[model samples]
Target: MADLIEKILSIEGGALAITRDTAAKLVNNLVQNGEVKPEEAQPLIDELVARGEAERDALREDLAAQVTTLQNTTQSIQTMLNANIKEAPERAIHELVLLGEQITNVQDRLREAEKQVEENTRQTLGQAQKQLRIAQARLVQATEEIRTGSIDEA
Candidate 1:
């Protein structure tokens, strides 16, 4: 096979001539050094270089796609955050207004309760004063009857 390949390459006159013995010696030397045969090495090296180039191209394309995707996602997130930031003060003011209204309602209810309690206290005090006045009148009438000695005449 090496002879046939060499013959094919020998079409051009004055090409380097490799005898079978020389070829065998070279192969032997390569094997002893744990190197691949020249016939096999060239094609393998070419194929590996091609494959490495293709892999690098694919990796570059993937990295570009990832960068584009990340940029878009970042922009979207920023937009959403910016919009939220813009509206935050308005939302906070609305919530504060609602809370204030609730506080006012609670204060009004408290004032009404206080007024009801005052009215009930005033009514109770008036009733107590009336009872005391009636008791004093009865005591005065009984003291006068005793001073007249009406019971002794009987």
Candidate 2:
């Protein structure tokens, strides 16, 4: 349980870090474009980062509860099997077979979910990278304009 919680926290932390970084970049772009005040950017960015961390903590708690429920269910199933094994061999075997089937179905669903998560993560990372590149290009352009003392010729 501890290991599972640790792993979940690590994944959630990474995701939240990426989200906070992306949000900061977007806010910086807004400041550059005069959509947001330069003085307001830091407070807004800090608020967003705090919100993301709070959300990550909430999700971690929910996942931990789910893990606990699963562990309890497994223990109950084991107890049931042990109690019935000698007195009701046939019924116990049938129950075990059904449990096996259910477990297999769950495993299949989990695999599908994992695949979807992987795909979504890939897409999100790609989009974030693209946004970062665009932000960098704009910064470079602004720097060149400053160096050359060129006003917007529009």
The lDDT per prediction is 0.67, 0.77
TM-score for candidate 2: 0.45
lDDT of 2 by residue, 1-154 (tens): 2342234336545435636576578668768988778897777667656666787898899999999999999999999988877669888788999999999999999999999999999999999999999999999998999899995788
**Candidate 1: segments with Cα more than 4 A from true spot:** 1-46, 149-154
lDDT tens string, model 1, 23-100? 455445545676656676444434434444565677789999999999999999999999999999999999999999
Candidate 1 global TM-score: 0.62
lDDT of 2: 0.77
Which portions of model 2 show Cα errors greater than 4 Å? 1-18, 89-154
Top model number, TM-score:
1
For candidate 1, the 10 contiguous residues with the lowest summed lDDT are 12-21
Question: Each candidate's root-mean-square deviation in Å?
Answer: 12.2, 49.0
Residue 141 lDDT, candidate 2, scale 0-100: 94
Worst 10 residues of 2 by lDDT: 1-10
